[model samples]
Target chain A: MTTSREIRLKSRPVGVPTADNFELASVELPPPGDGEIQVKNLYMSVDPYMRGRMTDRKSYVPPFELGKALQGGAVGEVTASNDPDFKVGDIVSSMFGWREAYNANPRALAAAGPMGGIMKLSTHGMPPQAFLGVAGMPGMTAYAGLLRVAALKEGDIVFVSAAAGAVGSVVCQIAKIKGHTVIGSAGGPEKVAFLKEIGVDHVIDYKATPDVTAELAKVAPKGIDVYFENVGGVHLEAALNAARPFGRFALCGMISQYNETGRPTGPANIIQAVGKSLRLEGFIVSNHYDLFPAFVRDMADWINSGKLTWKETVVEGVDRAPEAFIKLFSGENLGKMLVKL
Target chain B: MTTSREIRLKSRPVGVPTADNFELASVELPPPGDGEIQVKNLYMSVDPYMRGRMTDRKSYVPPFELGKALQGGAVGEVTASNDPDFKVGDIVSSMFGWREAYNANPRALAAAGPMGGIMKLSTHGMPPQAFLGVAGMPGMTAYAGLLRVAALKEGDIVFVSAAAGAVGSVVCQIAKIKGHTVIGSAGGPEKVAFLKEIGVDHVIDYKATPDVTAELAKVAPKGIDVYFENVGGVHLEAALNAARPFGRFALCGMISQYNETGRPTGPANIIQAVGKSLRLEGFIVSNHYDLFPAFVRDMADWINSGKLTWKETVVEGVDRAPEAFIKLFSGENLGKMLVKL
Candidate 1:
């Protein structure tokens, strides 16, 4: 038997989740049984969407149950394998995070569901942790949202909220690489600098700005054609206000309103959507797995050509996973917030 | 010479428009110039969307200018014509309403942008005024919004706001004709009865319901698949609250917020859009004239087969057009409100 440290949900959060809402625990796992593969997790992702799962409500992803090991995007190395599909030392990705190591049947892990199933990772000279960040769900989310949901067309001026975060960074870089003028909005000066470094044409420091809508209007005088929505509330209102006729908004996440105890007011200018013929579509990255092959191909080309880049804010150990997640709400992380085990 | 009595914008209304905001004026027009046609107005449409144009602001359609005749859908007979395309006594439709008679250059009338261009009406055993109501802009709006924008699919349970109004009534009947269960929402008992008379599966009197969201959830226990958003504010919020996963909202109009002095608060539960993967798209009927051929065909078939029916609240004369327009906001009209000249 092998003992692994894992974090479990101690209690459901009402508004903002605290460290007390989670508890680290030890789980004893027997050696890999028949058709089982043991994985030692290297890096675990802490995403804003996970906040939705912490609440006791039905959503696209099921609510995280109390007293269970929380699940998320994790990249792990195969330590022991009784299955032919996965071999020792092979890097694999699974929806089984919040743990240092786990021994499970390949069949059970395959049925783990939501996001990608258990699959061996092809590093392609990229770091294994990259799968959890830039080359993973967040990256795919930006790609599918911009290309499919938003139906990005030629000469589309794209505006992205949370431009320094995991999904937004990728969205910014992708829009830039596609030769479209990109406007990125982030909370702090550091994020603003990061957005400028990523070749964004216009960077709005939302924290510093008095009126986001005014700032956006000033920057994109002609109005934006596409809005990659990450933060909701004010950002959504700003996007609506700055959007040109027939602008499309990809409603990826609303991190700003996730922790509100009371129901958050939607964009006051949402009525503008009618006169402008705006299409606001919400999407899950999991629903867009079909775009993976194309995404991977484009990403590989961009990565090889040194046109694409990323950042990671790593928190060491599974014990600090909750801390890393909480930091996401405070806008502490510049890019992908990850727990390095 | 022809003397025409027309309604002109005296002053922009601060809130809901009133008779004081409008002034009846007389204009004398000479006989048809080269390529000009003289028209005698029969009926003019008074639609909710005209309220948007009344405001002096940049929008999809240009704002209605002050000290000018208010432009809208009107069916007229060409009394005199110098244009070879138009003959005497030929019925025509143009954006030349709120007046009794006028002489317009065929080129200028053809260039009269927004909605449908100037065209002769076939009438097809339907009333000539039906071209301005069910078979014209409102009817086509319902068809295009439902089939194309909302992408109404198999087994879609549709919910329509302003269900007894011109556009909404057509939407209710079209959905029913296509064999989809539809829930129609309208204010007042009269509108509710009108909805029921049109084969609407479920009728919701928004005036009587204290909580539209709860009422919607009650009626659609299994949840709604599509929402035709004609009335915004609380109706939009209710739709968001009651929408099922992957539900689509065709945002046609927002009459509830048209006259608001302050910026209207959007749906508080708009975040549910992301979790539910809902799509809310705003569209103008003018952009969808490409669907008109199919729309006219479908409407003709439905009208001929007696599968589709409509009602109109006709206010007599050009002078009463302002009163007819104001009645839309008060929900006094059971269906399409028109000005019979």
Candidate 2:
């Protein structure tokens, strides 16, 4: 019998989840039923938003149930298939659980499902790990949130927080491709340098800057036209103050306060959003599932043409997944933090 | 020479203006020049935004200069005219000053000028004072801010704060006309009653409701889709919490904290905006000048068809203009407040 190692939620976490909140165990893997495929996990993504799912509160998506395997975006290779569409050796990405190996029901992970069931990975120049970072959920998020929700235009100035992270990094690159002047904020000088190397016009080390608004103003003399919000609290307040009249703010994530026990202090200059006629919108990448094919095509073209570059911070083993996820909050990862089993 | 009583700004106040800030004096009304028109001011509008003009700081419009006549949206009768477009005994509205009588450079308020100046008013179907309130800047503000900026649609739920005030009252009425479920919050029971009489689906007296967000929850079980923001502070905070996912907020004014010495306390749960994917936009009516003609037509139709209602709290005499303007901040006036000369 095949065996799979799974990470299950032990309890609802109060604050930054400790290792005690999760339990790793091995279980017997069931043989694939008709129209199903057995997937051997390759890479498991660790994102900030997964922290929200750890709680039992009502959110855009349901919370993770205790004693259940923690689920997230994952890329795997099909080892066995009863379905004609997916053959052995075929690589695919799905919103599967944190498991070393499992049988994936074609219907459950199929592209026709509401939860954006599994899809075949593009056989382009980009690596399969890019499916979890750029050209995946994060890349689609930057595209939809910036171009669709934020309504970004050429010559607009963009300010992206958490610039070295998965989503923010792609947002900066997409904004640049659209002919926008891009400025980014990251936790350290190295990530800031990385952002600058990847076509970001300016980079602000948020840790080094005492006054975020002032630092943003110094970089964007004409003022920020588009603020791609990822880290909330002080960053959001600073963005509000620095935003020009009629600016557009894309509310993507709030990594700064995600691991807190209670609600974090929100922006203090929110009234400025009203006076300046700013547009702030929050969105989920799943809402734009219709655009995935279009996104993959464009992203592949960009990657082939040497227009877009991506980096992955891969944790070597499955046992390090929890540690890698926790490190995201501490700003330890330079790019997309993933666990390779 | 014809004698006219005029009120001018004697000095700029640091915070709230006292009687000493304004000077009432008699001035000689000169005869109309080549293209000038002599207007006998019948009613002078007193609006909250005039307070912003009292400060030396630059805003959407320039501040009212010290020792100069305080200009506002006013309606008057043309006693004499040298321009062919305007005739004697014609009642018109313009950005005239707080005066009993004055001569206007007809070219300054003409529909089409060398520099794209003000448009002349047509007093065909309703009260002349309507030109300053429901059919003027405030009316256009409610129309454009809601329709264009907020992208308000039929069947959407709406919430308006300071519901009995000039802009809010008009906003509620306009939303109702567009087939929206309208709820409003006002400072007193009387204003709440007025809001209901004007077709608001629900009314909350903010003075009585200690937790405005809780009160909003009871009334708006589905949560608000379009929020016409006028009074900021706790009300804004409540609105943010009560807004549904993908809701849109049109930030028009913040009367609640306008007089505060420093930056007003912003919304505490602004991070919720990211989760809900809400859209908040700040706007000025002056920026939407192109929508004026369409606004005038729709407002006139509503008025003539008895589909819309309005209230005017007229404070007689030009000397009472300052007190009338101050009453807006206190929520003492119902609907549009005007000072009759």
Best by DockQ: 1
Candidate 1 fraction of reference contacts recovered: 0.88
Off by over 4 Å in 2: A111-114, A261-263, B108-119
Per-residue C-alpha lDDT of model 1 across residues A223-316, encoded as one tens digit per residue:
9999999999999999998899999999999999999998688787888999999999998887888989999999989988999999999999
Q: Which candidate is the best by lDDT?
A: 1
Tens digit of lDDT per residue, candidate 1, span B1-341?
A: 99999999989988899999999999998998998999999999999999988899899988999999999999999999998999999999988999999887777656766444568888888889999889998999999999999999999999999999999999999999889999999988888888888889989998898989889999999899999999888899989988899999999998888999987878888998888889999999989989999999999999999999999999999999999999999988877899999
Lowest-scoring 10 consecutive residues by lDDT in candidate 1 chain A?
A108-117
C-alpha lDDT values of all predictions: 0.91, 0.84
Colliding residue pairs in candidate 2: A109-A118, A277-B282, A282-B277
Docking tier of model 2: it is medium
Q: Write model 2 residue lDDT over A1-341, tens digit each, in one string.
A: 68888888889888888888888988898888888889998998999989988988777889999998889988899999998889999998888848888886777555566674777876675677788898888889988888888889876899999998888898889888878899999988889889988999999999998988889889888888899999987788888877888888989888888877665676767767766778888887788878877887788888788888877888877677888888899999988999997
Interface RMSD of 1: 0.9
- Tell me the lDDT of model 1 at B144: 95
Candidate 2 chain A has its poorest 10 consecutive residues by lDDT at A107-116
Docking class of 1: high
